[model samples]
Target: MLDSGAVAEPFEREWFMRHPMRVAHDLVGAMLVVDRNGDQVVARIVEVEAYGGMEDLASHATMYRVGRETIGSAPGVLYMQRSYGLHTMTNIVAHE
Candidate 1:
């Protein structure tokens, strides 16, 4: 899950600290897996949030200490953190 073409986002650790509104609706193509007793559940990601990586201080991207240009260049990065025993997540859009 951390490899493949999908590398870990420098922002991966930040999204969890932000406020969450509605994620389940946005996560369509993204994989959603859960263990219910002995059963496993999974789904795709469809929707997500925007973490202005270069500008947002509370972003995992900020932790990298990369130059503004480098940070801004990153795209398709995803961040997820579980809170209160709940999962919180978001993504970074590609720069066009």
Candidate 2:
């Protein structure tokens, strides 16, 4: 059971519109919420990695240019891709 007053305010799009490094840093200690079948699950974000476009050699954008539409789009959008053709990697798009 949860109290209505215990709920935290949601992060806005502007909250994720900063530099990837900054966003990653700020994401620490944040809470991630998942609602499934009327059940809500909450998890704390402990760490995050920032990936800049073009310049970041490790960034998927370097190899997958087609993803720019979502990765370079507005903030708060989910950027997902398959890694090593096995695991699905999910990320939040940061600043342009």
Query: Which numbered prediction scores highest in TM-score against the true structure?
Result: 2
Candidate 1 Cα outliers beyond 4 Å, as residue runs:
1-42, 65-93
The TM-score of candidate 1 is 0.29
Could you give candidate 1's per-residue lDDT for residues 36-56 as a string of tens digits? Answer: 999965545566544455567
Off by over 4 Å in 2: 1-5
lDDT of 2 by residue, 1-96 (tens): 335577688889998888888988988887878799999888777767888876788877777865655666788777668877898766788884
The total number of steric clashes, by the backbone 3 Å criterion, in model 1 comes to 11
The Cα error of candidate 1 at residue 64, in Å, is: 3.8
Please report the TM-score between candidate 2 and the true structure. Answer: 0.74
